[model samples]
Target: MVAVSQNKSIDGRLVAIGCNYEPWIALLEQSGWKTHCCYDLRTADSILEEYSPCICVVDLSNNDFSLNSISLRANKTKQVKWIAIIKKEQLKTDAIRQFINNFCVDYFTVPIPGSHLLDTIGHQLGMLDIEASSWVEITSQHDMGLFGESKSIKQLRDMVRRVAMTEVNVFLTGENGTGKELIAKSIHNLSKRKNAPFVLVNCSSLARDDEKLSLLDGTYRNEEGAPFDGTLMLDNVEELSKELQDNLLAYLQAPSCESLDEEMASDVRIVATSSADLDAAVANGDFSKELYYRLNVFHIKVPTLRERGSDIFLLAETFLTKFAREYSTMASTFSEDSKQLLLRYSWPGNVRELINQVKRAALLAEGNEVKAEHFDLPSKANLKQSLRNIKDEAEKDVLVAVLETHRGQVASAAKDLGVSRATMYRLLNKHNIVPDVRHYNNGYARE
Candidate 1:
């Protein structure tokens, strides 16, 4: 029998289900628990939807109770913690064991004391409150300094939340302007080591092996004379040389760096970003397979501006507002035409490019409203050669955006764009665009 407790005096919300809920209900009521009871599985969904309870107590002693039905209900209410009350003999059945493992947080035999059951319920409720509180704080305070309301952005935010709960090495792969470093900082800020230092090592920027080694090995101390702790972000990890890759591999293999004591070593976590396809690099023998696997324990692929769709306008407007405040400009909003252009144009440089364009427009606008001309967008000219050139450039921009969206995976890019791999490569060659490499690698060729 499933039932809802009518008592409104309790501080917590719970749902109870089973054949013999009379005894369980009495126990729960005595413990001052507020619960919604559902006797039938058919009505369980409605009760769950209405109350949104954090904890669920299921009585498995009923011969008519279906584990599959309970599992479905549990899946529907993923945030709800389920506690199973079953006969001791039920533990011998593999199906029951699997069901409990998959759907329930805690299980009890028929003779479970009221105190023990209440304690388990209280603990789960406490944890739920903590998680909800953390989520609120993370979302309200620009958790990772990321701005977007698109489904893709929401998924990324959720992924960031899950990743921050652990201290494993993370690999972030995205286009050059997709704010990989920002995501890394967000992870660090949300992690347990938020109070510690977040050191960024741009693998591509360092030319010398010793410089790279010192940074990775924690020999390079900060201004505070402390070794890099908290999180170490290896930006553009694919740019690291084969020698540097080997050194990094060795460092990763070592339990603790010789330069730092155990305390410092234990405090550090690694987060790496790459614009190129590291898996392909490994296949092509350009990157170490061992290091790639080691660093890819948790991978986050940031979405490109185009993939984020209308979020482009959201980001553009945000940038405009920011730059207006910073430059003391009168530009308050984009003209109708300008908004259309912002939506239509393919952003090859992603978020970074949008910020730059918005800042420039904010600085240059003579009136309160920025016009289409304010943006550095393509012109609609009558000249045939110029028109052809404009078309080619637009095509290139789209190809580059899509390629970056897929993190330089030619096959994936082709599939996304609904073009065959051969045609994709042909188009790349036609546009003289190198797939996967950052725009800076070619001296920002489009610029």
Candidate 2:
């Protein structure tokens, strides 16, 4: 453990809980970040309190530390943003995975350079500053998948935090890809049931009904799993079957966890999400009114990407860079036309589509700049790209035919094609084609 930095003029305060990476610590110190390293969170409170708003990087790459103690400390210190560093293989363990899911706002899988995490740290600190100043007690930014300055996003973030403080059932409505599930998890993480398990039952993809759900008699029993102690998230609730709806409604009415003894009674909060309008579903007689009302105690509507104004650029850039890293591409920026098109288009698929398009663009781009044609744009762009594809295919076919006629001789091919040998080579390289010539005992043959 090391002493807290006395430097008042610094970028931010980083409380390293059980972090033993000295080179990374020195790098932060050199970069004017005040860092205090501690093992087992012994002096975490003092450092966190002094920093006013601090970031903690708990290193769980090794099995030398206790996750229980770290989780307990994190539970007590909700004000501080927590990130984790864990071994990639360690993520396969349920305990480590659950701890990361429950406590960390973000996590990095290591066997990576410490320098690679600098940008993440800096970005998180900037977001934390915005959250601290703009909204009270908004601990996680990326964790909630809500990063925007628009009024709709601001209201949603505020509501998530506010609703998280209470134990009432929450109903979330939004487009399919507007991050409704993230909102539910945020509420669960911020609520009193944070320490308990959060179970999600996706109603849309239910192969079979959960037959062991005992909700009729008020005291609920979840068979084949531990007793329900945390939040129960029913995602895509509009698709819930009639039988499941009855069971869920019964549970909502009684809302008690079955226990071996009366002293161990547990209560699980209900959080439901739907992309469709449940009110209309009820009016159309497609959904149960009782179930709808029970889950709609605190309703929240997530905003779409188009409604988020300048946030599209932020999201696009974030996804582009992220996918670039993943795929090792040179797609660093969007061309001017791409940006204009991005703003003008109404994102019906929302953030999910944006992520997919950007990922595809990044992978497709052979240069640093991505173009509108690379994106899954409207018909005009698609037609232009399709034409270009046709031209490329024709050109490649012509090149192959000429090369075959010339018996794979660059000089003969260049002369026959009336183009420079350099151009011929470039064409072959672009199409990723290689021509071979074979020699026989009597004559020459092409292979």
The local lDDT score (0 to 100) that residue 227 gets in candidate 2 is 50
Q: Which 10 consecutive residues of model 2 have the lowest summed lDDT? A: 438-447
Query: TM-score per candidate, in order?
Result: 0.70, 0.52
lDDT of 1 by residue, 1-447 (tens): 666653344344677777354565677777665444446776767777776646778888665677887888876573577888889999998988998977788999987677788778778888777776776676665325466899998888867876786778999999989889888988988788988878888888877455745755767677876766678899999988888898889888886646468654434689999999888899889999999999999889999988999688887777888789989999999899898878877777888888889988999999899998887866443234555777998999888878767777778889999999999989988988776445433321332
Q: What is the C-alpha lDDT of each candidate?
A: 0.78, 0.74
Top candidate, metric lDDT: 1
Model 2, 1-447: lDDT tens per residue?
423542344345677766764777777778766655556455766676677466777777776567887788776564467888888888788988888777677898775466876677777778666656544443435536676777888778767866786778999999989988877888887777888778787888764456434432325555744455778888888887887778777666753434244444556788889989788899888999988888899999999987897789878888888889989998899999899878777777888888888989999999999998898787556556766887999997887777777677767888998999898878788888666655212122223
Q: Best-fitting candidate, measured by TM-score?
A: 1
Off by over 4 Å in 2: 1-143, 207-209, 212-226, 255-264, 379-447
